[model samples]
Every structure is written in structure tokens, then in C-alpha cells.
Target: MKKIIFVDSTQIGLFTFQAYILELCNLNVGFGIYIETFDIPLVLFEKDASDVVRLSIDESLVQFIANKSISSRIERQQYFNQLLEFVKSSEELAAKIVFKEKEMEYLADSKYLVQMRNIYINSGNQA
Candidate 1:
């Protein structure tokens, strides 16, 4: 049996995520993970066992479904269909989550905002 993992790239703290994914692909590890990117079909990899361990990622969607050894092609197709429906329904929610994360990153990286935050903290203590 194989394993699968999901990674949301729209979120921060993923600096080494791409490198990690490539490493897994190069090493032909049975474990697989998928990450969503702004691009279509964001990232891809192959497994040695010919397992249908495929990944599909996009701006608001990150999904990876490893075909079970016991399952038939039709079953795999059903899994893909379900995943597509889930992505379609969750687009709005995913977009909101990604946007909020980016907004937080923007605020955290702003030196001016940091200085202002520090000033506010200091002034409150002086009261």
C-alpha cells in the first residue's frame, strides 16, 4: 500500500516545500504529497510501482489521490470525480483562506507596521 499527503502552498512556511516534493520524486519514495500553486497542474511526480499516485493542484485546490492496488480503473475515476466536485464547491472558501494567509504574511513582513505595533505596545505600558 502507498501513502498520500496534502500540502497547501497558498499558506506560508512552505519555503522548502517545492524542494521537498522534488526530492520525494527523485528518490522514488512511496510516500507522496501534493501542493497547490498559481499554475495549472502545479507539480507532478512518478512512482516506481506504476501506482496511480497522481497529484492535481491549483490556486485554490490541493489534492492527491493514490490509486489503491485493489481498486479498478472505474473506481479510480470515481475518486477523481468526487475530488473534482469537492474542489468546485470549496473554491470560495479556499480563496478566502489563501487571501487571509497572504494578508497576514504581508502584515508580518511590513517593517513600518512592526514599528507601529511596537510603539503602540510601549505607549500602552506608559499609561
Candidate 2:
């Protein structure tokens, strides 16, 4: 398993540092979840290893990905490619890109599901 650190802006204030632990669920695509406090995952490609792939998760699939298993590496790559194409091809999605949140089922039913959900629900503060 890979450990990625994320700095949550909402959690940072005055002088409080808290480490919220999140569990990894088998996406089954060989790709593990690298999400932090934020819903989006910072996907780094194998090529340059510097390029970050941003995923625009669909709302309908949020709970599904949260409840499903992970996927393989190749499957992840394919899914990523497909998402990229989807975003590029859809004018409605592309227009409101910044307003959408990304969601996937890779780390769905992990041991930390409850905790993760709690944190997300409490910290999200979204309408």
C-alpha cells in the first residue's frame, strides 16, 4: 500500500494539526486510492511521474465507488482514459468542471469506510 499525505485547508486554522487516517479499499484495478481530506484523488502517471490527472467524478457513482472494490492498474488506466474522454466530449461537464466532485469505487468497502464517511460528512460542509 502507498501512503500519500494531504493538507486540508478546512482543517488548518490557528494552530491545530490532526492526522485523519483513511483506509484503502481494493479498487481491483491495481490502482489504489490516494485521496486525502478532499474527494478528488491526485493521479500521477508512470511516464513523467509529474503529470497529475484530475478526475471529475459523477455524483451518481459516488456511493457506488465508495461501496465497491478497487480495480487493476490496466483497468484504472482504461477508466482514467475513458473519464478523460468523457469530460472532453461533454460540453455540459466541461462547462462546470470546477463545481463537480470526482468519485470512484476502488476504495469502497474498505475497513475505514465508516470513518472516511464520517470525516467526509463532517468536513465537506457542502450544500
Candidate 3:
């Protein structure tokens, strides 16, 4: 079975939260995690397992988040907490989740916002 976490990149601390989730998935060997960007779908992280967890983020969402004029650290933290809860919920939903191969392939080939390349590059360096 496979589970997916849809992330709104406009939220703050997204990279941090994603890193945290990836680490959690790493420690828990039962699940394998992969990251899918709006354009290119990359196996940013993976593990051997019978189940998969996909972190899906859109490039446009990242750009929107970056362009936002007003945001606070506290709000970002709260959003992160919500995401954590969503992940927990997804665990229970994993069994019921269904995905088609064609849909997955389309996601892999989709286009993403090119303006946020620097952010991704920076995050990659930090990782």
C-alpha cells in the first residue's frame, strides 16, 4: 500500500518539516518516503518496505509561499504540527488509499515553478 501527504508549500518551514518527516520515515523501517515536486518527481528519500509514503509539493505553491508578504514563525510551527497530525492520519488511511500508475506518471512529468530553483538548491545544500 502507498500513502501520500499533500503539502502546501506556501506554509513556512516546509523544508524543515519535510526533512523531519523523512527522518521519521527513515527511523521507522516499515515505510518508504519519496518526494514529488510539481515538475519533476524525485526519489529524494527511500527505504525498503512494503508500503510507501509520498510527500507531494507543487512548485507554484512554493512560489506563492515565498511571495507572501505577511507570515510568522509561530504560524509556521502550527502549520507544521498540523502536517504531522495529517501524516499520522495518513498512516491509518494507507490501506484504503488507491493510486493509478498513469496518474503517478503524470505527476512525475508535470511542470513546476522555475522561479524557486534557488530555494530548492539552498535546501539541498543544507541537507
Top model number, lDDT = 3
Candidates 1 and 3: which is better by lDDT? 3
Residue-wise lDDT of candidate 3 within 8-114, one digit each (tens)?
22223443222112233345412222233332222222323444434344454444444441334445445434544544443333323432221121122324212
Order the numbered candidates by TM-score, best leading: 3, 1, 2
TM-score of 3: 0.30
Model 1: C-alpha RMSD to truth?
21.1
lDDT of 3: 0.34
lDDT, candidate 2, 18-70, per-residue tens = 12122334321112122334343322211112322222223323343323325
Q: In model 1, what are the clashing residue pairs, if there are any?
A: none
Question: What range of 10 consecutive residues in model 3 has the weakest lDDT sum?
Answer: 99-108
Candidate RMSDs in Å, in order, are 21.1, 16.1, 12.9
For model 2, the stretches where C-alpha displacement exceeds 4 angstroms are 1-63, 66-70, 92-127
Error of 2 at 58 (Å): 5.5
Weakest 10 consecutive residues, lDDT, candidate 1?
12-21
Task: Estimate candidate 1's alpha-carbon lDDT, on a 0 to 1 scale.
Answer: 0.31
